[model samples]
Target: METLATTEIEEDVDRISHLPDFIIHNILSRIGLWDWIRGGKEHHSQLLRLSVLSKKWFNLTASFPYLIFRIDHFHNVSRLNFFKYVEYATSRFCHHHNHVTAHTFKLSTTLREPAELDIVIKCVELVLNKGVRVLSIDILSVLGVQRYRLPNILSTVSMLESLAINGCYLPSSFMVNALQFKSLIRLKLQYISIDDEVIKYLNTSCPLLQDLEIRRCNGFKIVCVTGHQNLQNVTIAHNTQVERIHIEAPNLSELWLDERRTMQMNLVSCKKLRKVTYFGDLLPNSNSGFLSNFPFVDTLMLDTKCNNLKLSSHSLRTLVLLSNYDLEDIEFRTPNLASMYSRKYLFTMQPSVVSDSTHLKASMHCNPYGYIDATWFQKLRQFLDKKNGLEVLNLHIRTTCSLEKRDLEKLKAIELPPYELEHVQLQLDTQEESSAHRNFVDAVFWCCRPRSLILKSSSPLIDFEEQSDIVKFTHEKLLEQEDQSRTKIQIVPSSSCEAQIHLSDLKSLSKALPSAEQIIKFIKEEA
Candidate 1:
C-alpha cells in the first residue's frame, strides 16, 4: 500500500511539472475565441476546461486581442446567443481597449427582420471603439431590403489601416464629408452603392492610401480619384460616371478600369503606369480625351469592345485581352505580347484579337459556356502556332468546347505546323468527380505542362477534390504505360505556384512523366 501511494504521488507531481511560458502561450493563442466561450457551457468542454488546467492559459486566452467572431450562415449558434456572445467576446477590446490588429465580423443573411439588423449596428459600434486596423464586412443579406443609413460608428476608428466593405449600402455622410480615418493605407470597396458623398471622401481622405478597388458599385455617380502622390495600384469597375477623368499620378504604377459607355479619361499623366487594363471603347465624342493622353506602359490588358485601340509609343511586352479584337492589323515596337493570354466565357462571340508580337501566353480563362466562332478561335491558335508563341493556352475543357476528342482532333489536324501545343484547361463541372469525368479533365490539362500556366477551377470544393484525386490517379496510370525513367512528371496541387507551369503536349507529359511520377511518389511517402 505504501509503495502504490508513493508511485501515484510521483506521477501526479510529474504531470504538474513546469511548462515553458512561451509554449503555454502558444497553446492558448491557438484556441478559437468562440470555442472557448461555448465550451464553458458544455459538459465535455474543451476550451473552458483547458483554462482551469493552468493560470497562465486562462490569462493568455482571455487577453488575445485578434479575435475572429464569425456569425455566418452555417453554425449551431442562436441569434440571441450570438448577439450576447459578440458583446461578451469583444468586451475585452471595447472596455479594456487593447490595440486590436485585426477584428472580423462576418454576419449571416438570416437576419430577416429590421430588429436583427439594429442589433448588428450596435455590435459594430462596440468593435469600432476597439480601434481596429482591419475591418471587413460582407453583407449580401441586404440585397433586397430597404437600406437604412449606417450611423457614423466607423468614423471613430482612426487607427484603421485596411478596410474591406462589400455588398453594403452606404449613406452620403460617410462617403463625402467623413474625415474619420486618416491612417487608412489599403481600401477595397466592392458592390457597394455609391453617390457624390463617397467620391469626395475617397479624394480627400486616404491621402496615404496605396491600393484602391472600386468595383461593380451601382449607385456610383462620380469619379474624383485624381492626383494622388502615394497611390500605386488602382482597379475601377463598372462606373456610370457622366464622363471625363484626368489622371496625373507619378507614383501610380498600375491602373485598371471597366468603365460604362459614357466613361472617358484623359491620361494627361500616368507616365510611370506600367500595368494598364483599358475596358470600354474610348467614345468617338471623347476625341479630346484620347488625343491629349499618352501611355508609356509595359503591360496592357484590353478587356472590352475597344477594337480601335492605337498604341503609339508603348514598351509593352505582355498583354492579356478579351475576345473580340483582331491582332493581325496591330503595330508593335520592341514589345512582345505573345507571353500573355485571354479570359472569356463559352459560346460567346469572340473576335480574333490582334497583336504585333508573338511571345503571347494564355494565363486567362477560356469561355466556360461556349464559343460561337470556331473560325476566329482557329485563327488565334494558328497565329500563336505560327510564331511559336504562347507557352500555355488555358481553356474551359467542358463548357468552352461543345465538341469531344474526335471533333478536337479534326480541328487540330487542319494544316497546322508541328508547333508543340501546350493546351491547359480545368474541369470545374461537379460531375467530373467520377473516374471517367476525372480522366476527361486530366486529358485536357495533361496535353501540355508548359513552362508557365495558371489553371483555375470553378467546381465546388468536394467536386474539386474528387476530380483532383481522379486526375492524379489517371496520371499514375499514364506513368505505368510510359517508360518510367524517360518521363518526368510533377503532380502539384492547383493551389501551388508550380501548378502555374504547363508543358508542351500530352506526349511531353508522357516523356516527363518519370520525373513527375517520382515527385508524386515521394510526396505521398513523406505524407
Candidate 2:
C-alpha cells in the first residue's frame, strides 16, 4: 500500500513538472469567475478543491475570480463570507498585477442608513480598488448621509460602462450634490426622481451618456438633449410633463413612455425612434391629447388597460395592444393594408374573404373583453388575400377570464388568407381551450403555412424575446426547479377584457417558403 501511494505521488509530480510556471499561471487566470458563480451553488466546493490539487494549481486557482459578491445577499452571506469570497477571487485574478478589469458586484436592497450603506460601500470599494467594470444596485431608497453614491461609484470605476439603481430617491439621496460623472455609456434607474437638477447634472456631468432607462419616475419638465447620437434607449415614465421632450438622439431606436399620472403624447419630434411603448391611464384629456403628427412608425406597444391607443403611422407595421378582451367593443382598421404600408380602405370582398399581405407584413395585438362579431375576422381575411400575396404576421390572444363554448368556438374558427401568411401566432387562455385550440392553429397553418408557430396559453404574449429580460430570467428560474407544478406556464386568466391575438403558426415543410406567385400555385395544389 505504501509503495502504491508513493507511485501515485510520483505520477502527480511528473505531471506538474511538465508545465512552466507561466503556463500554469495563464491557465489559472483564464478561469472565468462569473461562470462558476452562475453555474450553480454546488460549484463552491469544486472551486475550492481545485486549489488543493498542487502548489502551482493552488497559486493559480486561489487568485482567479469565482463569484460576483452582490451586497443584496449580504444578509444571507455574512460579511466574513463575502470578504472571504472576494479575497479568494481577487487573489486569484490580481495576484501578479494587483488589479483586474472584469470584476463585478450587484446589489438590490435599500441601504437603510449610512451604517448599513457603509458596509456595502466598503465592499464596493474593496472590489473597485482592485478593478470593476459593471455594478447594479437596486436601492429602494438611499437612507444614508453619504449623498454622492452616484459620484462615488462613477468616479471609482475606471472601466465602468454599465450602472443601474432601482427606486431612486433624489430628495433622500446623496448623489444630488454630484457635480460631474466621468465616462459612462449605459445607465438604468427605475423610479429615480430625475427632477430638473438631476437632468441638468446628467446633461453636463455625463456628456457621453448613451443608454438611459427611467421607470415609474416623476417630476420631469422636459428631457431635451442634443448630443449622444449613440443613445439607443430613452425611457421616461409616471410623469405628466413629457409634452416638451425634444429628443436629439439620432441613433435612438427604442422609446418607452408610462403616463399613469398625466395625459400628453404629442409625437412631432423623434425622427430616429423605432420602438414605442406607452402605458398608464391615458383617457385623452386636454392635458394629454392623442397624437396627430408622427413622422413615421416602427413598433408600438399600447397598454389598453389605461384605455388609450394610437394607430396612426405611415411606417406602422408591428402593433401590440394589451387590453381586456371581456368587453364586446371591436374596432380594427388597416387602411394602409397593401401599398408599402397600406394607404386605402375598402369594404369590397374578393371572391374569398381570407386575405394575405402582398406587400409589407403586419403585426397586431388585441386584448379586450366581449365577443367580436365574425365580421371583424371576415374583414381581416378579405384584406389579407393569402392566395396572391405573402405576409409576416404575429399575434397575442388573451382573456381576463374563461370564454363560453360559443365564443371560444368563434375564436377557434377564425382564419386568414392562404399562402400569403408567413408567420402566425395564438396567445390564448390555456384553461378554457388547450386541446381544441390546436385545430384553430392548424387551420391557419393550412392556409398561411407560416415559417414559425407560437402557441401560448392563458396569457397574451407569443414571442419569447419580446418579453422583458427580467421576466425571462424569472421564467427560466421557475423552469429550473425540480417541482413540475411550479414550472407550468399558466398564469392569470380573466374574462372581463376583450382578447385580440394575431394568430401565429409554423410551417410544416423544410423547403423554403414559396414566392407569392409560387405560393398561389402551391395553395391551389394544397387545397
Candidate 3:
C-alpha cells in the first residue's frame, strides 16, 4: 500500500511537470494583475516562490507588464524607508521588463511631507518615461493641508489612454493648451481639489475622452461637460458643495448622480442619453425643465421626496422610484415602459397612458416587533388591483427579527386577492430562525397563486440543516391545508446577496428539503 501511494504521488507530479510550457504560462498569466498584488501589498515573495518551479515560469512572471507598487505610511513606516523601498522596487521592475511596454502602472501611497511629494513626482516621471499607457496614482495625506501637485510632464505623455487620480491636486497654473492628453479616453478623479479652469482645460483638450467620474471632489462649483463628441458616460456623486452642473454632450448615453442637494442643472443636448439615476431631493423650486432635455431616455431611477412628480419622456422602459414621503400623485407618460420598481407608499399612479409593463417589483422595510397598520390592507389591495398586467412580481421585504406566533397567525388571516402571476419571488432578510419567513410564505400564498414560487433568504446563515426543519413543517402544513397540485415551490438562497460576498453557487437543492422530495418519491413508487 505504501509503494502504491508513492507511485500515485509521483505520477501526479509528472502529469503537471510534463505539461507544455505554453500551457503553464497561460495558467500563470490568468492570475491577473489585480489578483497578483492583493491586500494593498506587492506579492514579490510569492512570485519568488513561483520562480523556483521552473526557469520558464520565472521569466514569465518577471515579464508581467502590469507593475503595481502600494505603500501605506499609515502602518507606522518611516517616510524615508517608504521612499527607498518604492525606488528600489520600481528600478528592479523597470529593468526586468525593459523590452515590454507598460500596460498599467498603479502607485497608491500616503505622503505627508514636501520631501515625500518630491519622491512621488520622481517615481511618476520614471514610470511615464517607460511608455506607460494606463496610470492610476492615489496620494493621500493624513493632514489635509498638503496636496500632491502633478508634474508638468504628465500632459506630454501622448500615448496615455486612461488616467485615474485620487487625493492628488492638478497643476492649476498650466496654459489652457498645455494640459492636453490627445489619446486619453477614460478619466476618473476622486477627492481632488480642482477649480473651473482645470475643468475647462480638460473639456477643451481631451476631445477623445469617453468616460468621466467625479466623486467627493471639491474646489469647483460648476462642472461643464460640453462638446465632447466621444463622451458617453458620466457620474457625479456625494459632492455637497457642487451647486450647479451643465452638460451639452449630444452623444452622451448614461448619466448618474447622487444629488444630495438641489443643484441648478442645465442638461441641454444629450439626445442619446438613455439612462439617468437621480437619488436625492428634487424640490419644487429646482430646475423645472431639466428632465425634459433627454428625449430618448429608457431607464430612470428617482429617489426624491417631492409630493407631485410630472415627467414626460418618449422612450422609457424601466423606472425605479424610492421615496420616503407618501406619494400623492405621479404623472409618468412613457409609451414604451415595461418594468416598474418602487419603495413608496402608493396612493395613486396617473401615468397619462397605461404602459404595457409586465414586471413589478415592490420593496418595503418592516420591523417585526412593530404593529402592522390595519389601513395597509386596503392600500396593498388597491396596488395589487392596479397591477393586473404584471406577469412577474418580486417582493423584497426586510425585517429586523422573527415575528410572534400570534402575529403570524393574524397576518395569515388577512384576506388577499388572488393574483395570477406566472412567476412570484419572495426575498426576505432574516436570520437563522425562519418562522417569519414561513408566516410570510403563508401570506404570499393567500395573495398570489403563481405557477412557480421562489423563496430566497438574503441573510448569511444558509445551512441546510437549520433550514430543513422550517421547509419540512411548511411543506407538510401546506399539503394538508391546500391542494397545491400545480404549484412548484423552490427554496433558493439569495443569488444577489451571495454574489456580492463571493459565495459559491449551489446547483441542486434536493438534499436540503428531503421531506418534499421523499413525498414525491413515494408517490412515484405507488404509481
Candidate 4:
C-alpha cells in the first residue's frame, strides 16, 4: 500500500510539472476579480507558497496580475514586522514584472486612529502608482471616528475601468468630471455618502458609465438620472433617507429601485426601458403621471395599493405584483406577455394578452385557522380556466401551522380540476415537524395534481424516516390510478424565509431508498 501511494503521488506531481508555462499563466489570469479577495490573507499566502514550489511555478506565480492586500491579517503581528512583511511582498510583486501590468487590485484595512489611516492611504497610493485597471477599497473605521477620507489622487487614475468603495468618507472638496473618470464603466458605492454634486456628475458627466449600484448610502435626498446615452442598468437600494427619484434616461434598458423611504418618484422619459422593479410602500401617493411613462417597459414588478391595474405596454412580457392587500381588479393589454407572478386577486380578473401560452405562478397565504375550503379550490380552477393559454402553473402555499390526516382527506375529496400543474411548493413554520404534517403533504399532492411535488418543511430537523410514510402513501395512491407512475416526489428542509435546499440530503436518501441511517448521515453532514 505504501509503495502504491508513493507511485501515485509521483505521477500526480509529474503530471502537474509537465503542464506548459502558458497554460498555467492562463489559468491564473482567469481568476476572477473577487475570488482572490474572498480568501482573505490565506489566499496571498498560498500564492507565495506556490511561487517556491519549482522554477517554472515560481516564475508563473511571481508574475501574478491580480492581488488583494488585506492588512487586518497582521493585527496580531508586531507593527514593525507587519510593515516589513508588507514592504517585502509588495516590492517583490510590483517590481518583478517590469512589462506586465496588474489588472486588478483590492485593499481592505481597518483604521483605528490617524496613524493607521495614514498608513492605509500611503498603501493605496503605492498600489495606484503600480497601475491597476480595477480597484476596490474597503476601509473600516474600527473606532467609529469616520476620519478616513478618500484621497484626491484617485481622480488621476486615468486608466481605471471600474472603481468600488465601501465604508470610507468622500472628502467635501470631492470633484468628479468627464476628464477625471473618462474610462470608468462600472461604479459601485456601498455605505458611503455622496452629495447632490456627485449625483449630478454621475447623471450628466461620466459618459462611459454603463452599470451603477448604490446600496445603503446617504448624503442626497434625491437621485436624478437624465439624458445619459451609454448608461444601461442602474440599481439603488436600501437608502432610508432618500425621498425622491427622477429618471429620464432614454437609452437606459433596466432600472431597479427598492427604497421604502422614498415617497415620490418620476420616470419621465424612459422610452427604451425594458425592465423595472419598484418595491416601495408609498404607492397610493405615487404620481399617476410617473406610472404612465412606461409604454415600452417589457418586464415590471410593482408593490402597490392601486385597486385597478391598467397596463397598456404592448411589449410587456413579464409582470410580478406583491401587495399587502389584495387587488380588486387588474387589466393587462400586453400581447407578448409570457409569464406572470402575483398574489391571486380577491375576485377572478382576466388579462387581455393574446399569447398562445403563458406561465403562471400564484401565491396563497393560508389562514392561521388551517381552513382549506372547497371554495378556495373552486376559485383556483375558475382563475385557471379563464386564462386559457396557461401552459404551466406553480403554487406557493405558506401555511402557518401543522395539519392532521383529516385535513389531507378533505383536500383529497375536493372537486379539483384535472388540469396539470408544473410544480407545487409548501412553506410551513419551523417548529412544525415533518412527521405530523403528512396529511398536508398529501393534500398538496392530490389537489394540485402537479407533475412534480416538492415537500419542504421549515425545520431542519426533518429526517428521511419522517418523510418515508408520506412517500409510501403517495406511491400507493398513485398506483390506484393508471398512468401516474412517472410523477416525481422530492423532499427538502429549509427555513420559512429561505428557498435554498441542499441536494446532498436527497442524494443520501435515494442511495439507500428505505434506510434511516442515510438520512441521519445527511443531517449530521449538514450540522
lDDT by residue (243-350, candidate 3, tens digit) is 888998988989988858877777757888899988777656543344675667888888776656666665877777776533224555555566665565322222
Per-residue lDDT of candidate 2, residues 2-29 (tens digit): 9999878867765763687557656654
lDDT of 4 by residue, 1-527 (tens): 99999777766665655786557767666654233334444657666655544446656666666666666654455555554445555566678777766677776766666666666666666667777789888877876655567777676677788988999886444555433677888988999888777888766546688888898998888888777777888899988688877877768888888886446767747777889888765445343333465667878887755655556555777777776433325555555666566654422122332112363333222222234433444445544543444434433344555565665566567666555544434444434565555555454445445443444443433555655554555444434333534433233322211322334354444443333221111111111
Model 4 clashing-pair count: 0
lDDT rank order: 3, 4, 1, 2
- Choose the strongest candidate by TM-score: 3
- The full ranking of all candidates by TM-score, starting with the best, is 3, 4, 1, 2
Over 4 Å off in model 2, which ranges? 1-44, 52-67, 71-99, 109-116, 128-131, 139-153, 156-158, 167-182, 218-220, 238-244, 263-269, 281-294, 305-310, 325-527
**Against the true structure, what is each candidate's TM-score?**
0.56, 0.54, 0.62, 0.60
Off by over 4 Å in 1: 1-53, 96-110, 140-148, 169-172, 175-178, 260-262, 285-294, 306-313, 324-338, 342-527
- Pairs of residues clashing in candidate 3: none
In model 4, where do residues sit more than 4 Å from their true spots?
1-25, 30-53, 56-63, 70-88, 94-100, 144-146, 171-173, 176-179, 248-250, 262-268, 283-291, 304-312, 325-336, 343-370, 374-527
Compared to the true structure, candidate 1 yields what TM-score? 0.56
